[model samples]
Target: MAKFKLFKDRKGKADQAKNNKFVKLGREIYVQARKGGPNPDANFGLKTAIHNARQINMPVDNIERAIKKASGNGENVEYDEIYYEGYGPGGVAIMVKCLTDNRNRTAADVRSIFNKRGGNMGESGCVAYMFDQKGILIIDREKFADLDEDILMMQSIESGADDIVTNEDSFEVLTHPHEFESVKSAMEAAKFEFSSSEVSWIPQNMVGVEGENAEKLLKMMDAFEDNDDVQDVYTNFEISDEEMARLG
Candidate 1:
């Protein structure tokens, strides 16, 4: 399998990371609802945010509370969506998306993590141009044991998918940002379900990281995700399978 920037593996720290995921996801849902209103059916962003939260088994109560907060029935905090760009230990481009009520605090925390982890924060557009914003939907192979890859590819293409990448355990459908909802809806109408779905900044090219640099890069990403203000992170770094095994 190609070493794409899948951040699911965290050097055996999945449990720790998951504990913090709910808070960040709650913030994301709140921000989305606040921006587009609390009605998920009428708000695509809110619907996607709620879908992602549910995918992780986030509590229904938490999801509803976030919507209530956004609707002015709960907390009145307003968050700003911000993006930070930088280079990791191996000169791999990294972009962090944040939703925070306090910009200065989030900026300081991000900069400190980067500096302490053998990285340096760059100007706003420094690494943004190296990535493409696309919608990615992942379908597990195990879930559709009888579905052939060719047929899936054909369906994806006919539904306006930009590309279909067959990974070792799943099929990743890529779509233009504007066409994401259409493609996803078409697949759902055909009784297909996604393992995960999101619009993300995909790296145009990957930079290999090994040895000490790879370890440091992973730790750095964990730090970013552990932060309360950070919503998601994107990177161009790719670690070898051997290195990943060693890290595990």
Candidate 2:
């Protein structure tokens, strides 16, 4: 829920970022484990959460502890999934997905952040229409430079990916939500390593924000990410390099 920095630029903040990621992943794992069951094989959601945590290099001990806690008394935890919609500076559509045991507290916090950042919180369906849920698989381009792109693309397609594209830094595979796991499994079987895999709500079109607008938007996002209950944040805003430089 911050400025979209390319992965290569995160070395300085990688440790903190990783720690935050662990907390988010642990919450997700705990929720899934409690709701479905602690056994990954028997619970699809738990299995997926574990897979996601592993992708981020979360420690095995940490992962197991989350499940153990869930198996013990996590069922008593009454977390509610809430979606907050808002418009950021420059009218950028935003969606904040949260899982909190205290709805009133989360709502107040989210509303305050939005207000402080010069945005207005809206009803649930306000901005969701502008995004589409899709599965994304990303691989480091430099790591797979020796592979045959045509074959890799072909294989990915044969394995149920919707499309594969190569950018300067990474190779991205797009898939329908339901086909995500199968495609990832096929890629793994074919010895392809992924940098990330997730089901995300991607914006249909990007709205540009600059100067004050960009600053406010990023601040609002940071506030959301800082909240333990806020799981994911999505926005349809794009900032220019010049604006990002000024922000930095």
Top lDDT: which candidate number?
1
Tens digit of lDDT per residue, candidate 2, span 135-183?
A: 8888877877787889889989989999886777788788899998888
In Å, residue 173's CA in model 1 sits off its true spot by 0.8
Worst 10 residues of 1 by lDDT: 1-10
List the global CA lDDT of all models: 0.85, 0.81
- Judged by lDDT against the true structure, how good is candidate 2? 0.81
- Candidate 1, residue 43: Cα displacement in angstroms equals 1.3
* Residue pairs in collision within model 1: none
